[model samples]
Target: MSVPVEVIFKRPEALRDRPTHYCPGCPHGIAHRLVAEALDDLGLRERAVGVAPVGCSVLAYNYFNCDFQEAAHGRAPALATGIKRGRPDTIVFTYQGDGDLASIGMAEIIHAANRGEKITVVFINNAIYGMTGGQMAPTTLVGQKTTTSPYGRDPEQIGWPIRMAELLSTLVAPVYVTRQALYTPQLVRKARKALHTAFRLQAEGKGFTFVELLSSCPTGWGMTPVEALEWGKEKMMAYFPLGEFKKPEAEEGGKK
Candidate 1:
C-alpha cells in the first residue's frame, strides 16, 4: 500500500510564487515574509493594498500577490493615505525605507500619523541606503561609513539619527507604534508578532499603526552575510532598541 505524503510548511498565500530579487542577507525578504504571513493569517490578502516607495523595496509589488502601487521617492504615505481614504474597505499599507520615510517624506508621515489614518506602515531601517549605492540614511548610526558619509557619520557635522518609532509614538493619533529587529531567529519571531499586531489593529479600524524593523543589508554594508547579521545585532540593535513604543487602549479598538 502506498502512503500519503504530509505537508508540514509552506509559503504564505500573500507572497508571489517566485523568487525575490533581494540580495543575500538582506532583511527585506524577511520583512516581506512577515507581512505576508500576517496578511495570510488574518485573511486580509484579498483586501490588502500595498504602496511601495523608492529604495531597496521599490519593486515590492512584484513580490506580493495582492494589489500593489508604486509611489515616488518619499511619497508612500501620501499615496497610502489617498488609497485608504478612497476605499475604506480595503486595507492599505506602505512599505518604506529610512531614506524615504525619514528624509523627504518626514512631513507626510508625521501628518498622516497625527491625523490618525487607519493604515498600517512597514518601515525597514537598514541604517544605510540599500538601493542608491549604500548612502547614509537618516537612521544611520554615528561613526558608520557609507557612500555619502565616506569618512563615517559625524554627529557634530550632521544631525543625529532620527528614531522614527519613538517620534511617531509621541503623536496622539497613532494607536500602535513599535520597533523590532530581524538579526536572529528569536528577534525575527518578535518582529513577526509586531507585524501581526499592527495589521490586526489596522483591520479593526484602529488609528495609524507603524512597525519599524531594523534589518541587515549585507551588500550595502560591504560585509559577508554572517558578518552583516553580527554587525547589525551589535550596532543597529543597540541604537534602535526593539519593543512597542505605543499601543491601543481598550476604547481605541471601538472605531470602525
Candidate 2:
C-alpha cells in the first residue's frame, strides 16, 4: 500500500535551513519566519538587504538568506537610509530590538521615519534588554523587573515604556506604521499579515514602513516559555495595543 503524503507547508526560500540559536520559545524565530514569508510572497528575496545592529538579533545575518550589513548600536536606521538611497531598486530593512532602537537609536529611527525613507523596519520590543543582559530599556514597562531595575521599573525615575507605533504614526511622511505580537496563534496570524503589508508597501516604493512586534524573551524576563507568552499577552499587549496606527492614503492610482 503506497500512499502519497502531501506537504502543506515548508521553509521559506528567503530563510536559511540552519539551526536556530534563539532560546526555546523565543519569538525571534517566529518573527524571522514571518519576515521570510513576506519576502517570499513578494518575490523580493533577491533584492532584499537587511541591516542588523547590536543586541540579540545582531547575528541575524547568519539566519536570513539575504545580504546583511552590520551597523553600530543605534545606527541601523542611519545606515539603512544610506543603503536605500544609494540603491533605490533594492529592498532594505532593519531588524532591531527595543534597547537597540527605542533607546540609543531613538533619534535615528524618528528622523528616518520623518524623512520618509523608502525602507522597512522590523522592531522587536520585549520590554527589557535581551542580548546585553536583562537591563531596563526605553520600552521597559513600569513595575517590570530587570537586571538593572531589580526592584521593578519606577515611572517616577525611569518613565513609561515608549509606544513606538503610536509615536511614529504621528509623523506625516510614513506610509505604514503598525504594532503586532506573537503571543497567540490568532495574533501571530495578524502579525504575518502586518509583515506582508509592510513589505508590500516598500515594494511599491512607498516611503517608510515600520512594524513593531511585541516579542517574548523568556530568558530576559526570567520566566518559563509559557509564562513569558502569558506575560506578553497580558501585560505587554495591554500597554502596546496591536493594530495599524497609520496607513497609506489614497494616491492617484486609488491605492490606499
Candidate 3:
C-alpha cells in the first residue's frame, strides 16, 4: 500500500491566497497571518472589518479576505470608530504602523481608546518609517539613524521614543492593552495568543483593545531579514518591553 500524506500546515481561510508585496524578511507577513488565523479561530472572518490607513500597512485591505476600508494617513482609528459605531454587530479592527499610529494619528488613536470604542487595534512598530523611505518615527530608538535623523535621534532635540503600550495602559477607558513581538517562533506563538485574546474580547463587546507588535523592517533598517529579527529582539524589545500592560478586571464593566 502507498504511504498516505498528511497536511499539517495551510493558509487560513480568512487570508486570501494572493502573494503579499511585503519585502523579503518583513514581519508584516507574519502579523497578517496571525491576525487571519485568529479571525479564523474565532469565526469572525465574515464579520471583521479592517481599516488600514496610509503607511506600510495601507495595503492590508488587499491581503485580508474580509471587508476593509482605506483611510487617510493617521486616520484609521477615526474610520474604525465610525465603522464600529455605525454597525455595532460587526467586528472592527485597524492595522497601523508606527508612523501611522504614533505620529500623525496619535491624537486619533488616543481619543478613540479614551472613548472606549469596542474595537481591536493591531499596532505594528518597526521604529523607522518603512513605507516612506526610512524616516524616523515616534517610536524610533534614541540613537537610531533614519533618513529624517541621519545623525541619530537626539532625545534633547526630538525626545525619546514613545512607549505606546505603556501610554495606552494609563488610560482608564481601554479594557486591554498588550505588547508582543514576532522575532522568534516562541514569541510569535505568544503574539498570536494575544491577538486571539484581543479579538475574543472585542467580540464580547469589551472596551478598546490594543496589541502592539514589535515588527521587523529589513528594507528600512538596511539589514538582512535575519539581522533585522535579531536586532528587534535585542534592541527593540529592550525599549518596548513585551507584556500585558493592561487587562480588564474580572467582571469589570466594559463599554460597548
Q: What is the lDDT of residue 100 in candidate 2?
A: 90
lDDT of model 1, residue 247:
84
Error at 230, model 3, angstroms: 0.9
Model 1 pairs in collision = none
lDDT string for model 3 (128-219, tens) is 89887899999999999999999999999999999999999999999889999999999999999999999999999988999999998999
Backbone collision tally, model 3: 0
As for candidate 3, its clashing pairs are: none
In angstroms, the error of model 3 at 51 is: 0.4
Poorest lDDT segment (10 consecutive residues) of candidate 3 = 247-256
Residue-level lDDT tens digits of model 1 in 1-256? 9899898988899999888888977888889999999999999999999999998899999999999999999889999999999999999999999999999899999999999999999999999898889999999999999999999999999989999999998888899998999989999999999899899989999879999999888998999999999999999888888878888666343233
Q: How many clashes in each candidate?
A: 0, 0, 0
lDDT per residue for candidate 2 within 67-144, as digits (tens), equals 999999999999999999999999999999998999999999999999999999999999988888899999998999
Question: Between 2 and 3, whose lDDT is larger?
Answer: 3
Question: Each candidate's TM vs. the true structure?
Answer: 0.96, 0.96, 0.96
Ranking by lDDT: 3, 2, 1
Over 4 Å off, model 1: 251-256
Cα RMSD to the true fold for all candidates: 2.5, 2.2, 2.6
- By lDDT, the better pick of 1 and 2 is 2
